[model samples]
Target: MIFVLGMINAFAANPAPPSPVGRTRPPPPPPGLPIDENILTMMLVALLFGIYIIYNFKIKQKTPM
Candidate 1:
């Protein structure tokens, strides 16, 4: 299908490059707000909540009048 071919082309065009051959350290977060595991957890929870709301809306729309 055209969609499948497009996806393949997209992936081929944006292939991830290999990492540099040297010692690497993670960059520090911004000064104001520190990005830590807690922030990541909250973001994940918010994302899941958004998905749940959208799913509920779709289910309600599908029910018989």
Candidate 2:
């Protein structure tokens, strides 16, 4: 298409500026809580407890006379 060719020519005419070299960025902030096996175990236990509660409620609802 003419539009596509025109766009390609326009981009080719102007190139992007070169990036700065040897720039040192600041280090990222540390996490609030340390992630270890204890944290992982707690999360897994909470998820299983929530699933157990929901399953029991559904079973109770389906047991009508």
Candidate 3:
């Protein structure tokens, strides 16, 4: 399956280095995201509220002909 091929490729891409005492080196820390967490959360909430207001004003149908 595709999952098996992906796993094989992942292992091949980053192989473990040989050690005389059979010990491996620790991995480096991961890179950070583009935006700060607080700003990202605020932007997401604003976007959701804007979408809700737009949907209610422009998309919703009124009752009675």
List per-prediction Cα lDDT, in the order shown.
0.84, 0.84, 0.82
Tens digits of per-residue lDDT for model 1, 4-55: 9998899889667667666387556769856684988899999999999999
Candidate number of the best TM-score? 1
Q: Candidate 3 residues 1-65, lDDT tens each?
A: 99999989998896677665855766678878755759978999999999999999876778777
Q: For all candidates, what are the clash counts?
A: 0, 0, 0
What lDDT is obtained when candidate 3 is compared to the true structure? 0.82
- What is the per-residue lDDT of model 2 for residues 1-65, given as tens digits with 9 covering 90 to 100? 99999999998896775565765875568887766849888999999999999999998886658
Instruction: Give the 10-residue window scoring lowest on summed lDDT in candidate 1.
Output: 14-23
Please give the range of 10 consecutive residues that has the lowest summed lDDT in model 2: 18-27
Instruction: Rank by TM-score, highest first.
Output: 1, 2, 3
Which residue pairs clash in candidate 1? none
Can you give the lDDT of residue 35 in candidate 3? 56
Q: What C-alpha lDDT, on a 0 to 100 scale, does residue 44 get in candidate 1?
A: 94
